[model samples]
Target: MSFITINNIWQEYGDHVVLERLNLQIKEGEFCSMVGASGCGKSTFLRLLLGQEKPSRGTITLDGKRLVAEPDSHRGVVFQRYSVFPHLSVLDNVAIGLELPQSPLLGRLFGAKKRAAREQAAEMLKKVGLGHALDKYPAQLSGGMQQRLAIAQAFIMQPRVLLLDEPFGALDPGIRKEMHAL
Candidate 1:
């Protein structure tokens, strides 16, 4: 069975239609990419996959079960724009993902849990070449660096499915290539 199945999906916003007659099946460990002109529903489709929106018609199933229209740890996304918190340091931005899931009420981890989360965030940042900028804020970094920070933030969650929306658009060729590898 497919890992993800989109059956005759359609997306409509009142009088306007964003997507139509879209069907897809993805096997486990498979990679897929969608390309189209602007305003053509690529992001909309991604949002559906992320469970941020429900399609107007048809159904989407993940791992043979109906997909829920709510965000969960199973999926991680990096938007075209940097989604990192400008007020937080790079390390904290990434670490917050780890902290929130475990402490939804207080929205924080205390003592050793907090330290472990930060350490894990630091390790992920190092993998994305942002280790040196751990103390910097999003505003202090360049566009490409900020994009990498967003990627690190998403990756720190270790989600089952990762969705990237023009994530490398701000990166130079070298950095873009490195991100593809990472």
Candidate 2:
């Protein structure tokens, strides 16, 4: 059996049907891509898998367990726009997820734990080629750099599944290729 399964899925908003009777299976450690014209069900399918939206019919299961309706640390996501925090520095933004599990109310990671999170965030950003922009605010970076930061932020959490929603929509070809390499 596959690790992720979508069985006879259906999604709709009032009278508009986005997805209908879709069946898919994804195995562990496998890479899958979805391609279609704009306004197709690609984003909807990703959202369903992420539990951002529930199926109007049928079921989605991960590892044989039905997916719940809420966002959680088990899933990571990067949207095309507004993925980064404008107020936080790049390093701080990347470390936010690392801090969350330590304290739900305050996220008061300090001393070595804080430093370790910062180091890991730096490594992740460097992997995505954003090391030099660690101290810069999101608004100070270019569109492509911002997207890289978003990817790093998502990756730092080490989520079981990563969902990207048109993340490369605004990048030029060269930047897009670089992002693909990361």
Best by TM-score: 1
Q: lDDT of all the models against the reference?
A: 0.92, 0.87
Instruction: Summarize candidate 1's per-residue lDDT along 47-134 as a digit string, tens digits.
Output: 9999999999999998998988898888899988768798999999999999998999999999999999999999999998999999
> What is the C-alpha lDDT profile of model 2 across 78-168, one tens digit per residue?
9756467789999999998799888788875888999999999999999888889899999999888888888888889888888888788
User: Which portions of model 2 show Cα errors greater than 4 Å?
Assistant: 172-175
Model 2 C-alpha RMSD vs. true structure (Å) is 1.4
Error of 1 at 10 (Å): 0.6
Report lDDT (Cα) of residue 131, candidate 2: 89
lDDT of prediction 2: 0.87
For each candidate in turn, the TM-score is 0.97, 0.94
Most accurate candidate by lDDT: 1
Clashing pairs in 2: none
Q: Any residue pairs clashing in model 1, and if so which? A: none
